[model samples]
Target chain A: MATIGIILFTLVVTLAVMLGKCQKKPLSNACASFAFNTEMNNLQGYLLPQECEGYVAGYVNSGQYHSDFAVAIEAARTYLNTIEADQDGKDLIVLDIDETALSNMPYYVDHHYGVETFNGETWNAWVNNASAPALDAMLSLYTDFRAQNWSFAFITGRSKSQYNKTAQNLYDTGYTGWKTLVLRLPDEENLTADEYKSKHRKRLEEEGYRIKSCLGDQWSDCSGESAGKRTFKLPNPMYYIY
Target chain B: MATIGIILFTLVVTLAVMLGKCQKKPLSNACASFAFNTEMNNLQGYLLPQECEGYVAGYVNSGQYHSDFAVAIEAARTYLNTIEADQDGKDLIVLDIDETALSNMPYYVDHHYGVETFNGETWNAWVNNASAPALDAMLSLYTDFRAQNWSFAFITGRSKSQYNKTAQNLYDTGYTGWKTLVLRLPDEENLTADEYKSKHRKRLEEEGYRIKSCLGDQWSDCSGESAGKRTFKLPNPMYYIY
Candidate 1:
């Protein structure tokens, strides 16, 4: 009877182990766990397009994307009205370059959402093309902010060499009047986008500008000390940057 | 009769859910899910010292730490011999400070493995003390490398301000004769450790040094472009740096 009971326990344990494996998550035991379906979900709070290409593509290709941005615009308009800008303190909005202001959907679509790994050469080529379309929601928000007399600072992790192309791209996409355009210097290439952006915001503050709203798709955009009074995080589960 | 059957089924499901929660291993659904647990595990490989106080203390207090170091030394020696280094290409090893060469375990112990978050003032005080013990394994490996005529370059995320204290600590802890000590400049404070280290490694390459092996306790230590011929990652789950 004892032996039979032991045999039953073994069978149950084996079944449990098999069930665990079938849950469709990445195995953290291996070194290649980064960009795995599970790691992307845990760290980025969304699924990669590679994992569900159809769903993400469908969401972005449809009117649903427009609806989501509309809601964000509503919130931004309310916040902009709440704060009163005076001559003593110049009101400013800090914006991220990628995904937040511009859509890299074409690049992501070609690469399978980083499933094939991010190739720098190809990405640089895409940046040079400067054909990325404006995210309508962010573009709308930018117009509203401009109407309210708020100045803008565009901070990006793009290399300093790409400054001209990026500026042209923004202009072509209808970003008319940003007061400052901060690009990552070659020496500052080691800084994470978050760290790089935070420093730029601090520099603006030192120069006597008050950041009323900071907007980005990644948590790193709105995180760290000296963050603005309001932060709006748009949805981008497609990719994450440290 | 139908209501009673439905109640019984609900009770059984609840019991199963409770049992799943009580399991010893991490739940894929829970906060300590496999990927999060894996990230923590990868960072603090096999060391629960921060999360579980007594377990880490018990592991380090025992001869287990030394044994683990011995295993690492063995791996390093085998890899060192396997690679061919010549006079044409000066063989170099990149070393990271803090937990890679000298341990901050004492500080972690005092603070309960940073359960209270990293306090810079207290950590600076500890750095000022400069009494951190050398990892017997890494120290032994260093001696072996020196014997083989391979030069050493110490590149760390430590600020330039901490150079004197860090150098003193290394000397007191038995590290002697390194080619260069690269400290993070004040302007480079915003750079992620990985980016800073990668740039330093790249600079060394440009200056005609061939990095044979790079060792650190974090993935950022081994990742990015211009990484060494080989990378060795030591276990460090106490804290994470972006």
Candidate 2:
């Protein structure tokens, strides 16, 4: 019988790869979930203890982490109301550094990801395991957009010899207001760090400044031709890079 | 018949709550991945050109773009043998801007992962759909480490009001060399951007230079405290946050 139908198709593909590595969803399975904020905050079950410790119990037991933090706080309040309606000289917000700020998947499930076979001694033992925690209030609304003067940059993917261990793990995590860490020069040649953030935002829009909002966790940090000036998003289900 | 078996058990729990939106990948499958040096230069099995249509599917299909020139040539010869074993005087290699160099993930898969029902008309229709090509010999070795003198800094988490759309996305991608661009500080008290990159690597070890190496894609950019030095990881795997 064709070797018993190839041994029942190798036991149904090894039970579908052990059910996809035992998938997951038991933080008391409120039944996997549908969430888009569970019909805009109607939330019938759990997921709030600080977003169940910053999500991942199959997205808070299938709840989609409160509809993805209400769509990343409604895309950071529509990018702070389009940089407070930028009049042109003070209105900025561009952010995109590793999954849009912070969260490393417990260092890729404590070094299980391995990515592309890299090995700086098990990646310095997963950067000495500092442990991933923050995401709530995301550094106090980026320090209330630096008390509204509005200026923040972290644009990251990390290159140029990881500037002293990504600045000592963000100085041990406090994410102060922000200065301007852009990284990835490794030796440069006609720019590539997203075209040096689009020629440093066209030299701060010819030295006047209007950017008016751009955030990340990807989506081109504002979307192309070297993005920004009105885009905000944050809620990277986990790993990234495309 | 027991009310038709209780209406077939409420139609199998309403089809298991509408197929539970089938997850195991989808929040736009985190935007359908395909990177990690195009699957470690294997080009994820063919089909590229037309200026890399929908890109992120490289590893083999044809093979040409050598931006990360095979792990930046073994991480720039182990970053010039760790700055010629320390006594090499000037050793600067710090960077972190927009996903560790360049790559925004087609603006986060054109706004599907962010979700809150994505607005701004789907993020300006994915920024008028921009092109996403890069990795050119690791950006020509970051312009040969700024003509070999060796110095670069791009530190970012973007907050200082998106510094002109991150300097116009680094001048539309023709990035230039830099020394200072350390963001996060308008009463920065939340700190998480890797503790604001260990206070800008103690101001580059008090501007005495000799950083040796650091690079990223994650592991908090090689966690900090600056010991000896050497971190060159890449391959974001789409996203991470620990």
Docking class of 1: incorrect
lDDT of 2: 0.49
Highest TM-score: which candidate? 1
lDDT (10s digit) by residue, model 2, range A1-242? 55545554555455445554455434222221212112111122222332323344455335444345434544466447544533332555666655455566566544332223445675555544544455555555776667666776666646656656665665567666565666667555345545666666556556665665566654434544434433444544333332
Name model 1 segments beyond 4 Å from true: A1-242, B1-51, B62-66
Report how far off residue A211 is in candidate 1 (Å). 35
Quantify how close model 1 is to the true structure by its C-alpha RMSD in Å. 12.8
lDDT of 2 by residue, B127-150 (tens): 333333334445556676667677
The best candidate in terms of DockQ: 1
Question: What does the lDDT come to for candidate 1?
Answer: 0.69
Global Cα RMSD, each model:
12.8, 24.0
Q: How does model 2 score on DockQ?
A: 0.01
Off by over 4 Å in 2: A1-83, A86-197, A207-209, A215-242, B1-200, B207-209, B215-242
Among all windows of 10 consecutive residues in model 1 chain B, the one with the lowest summed lDDT is B26-35
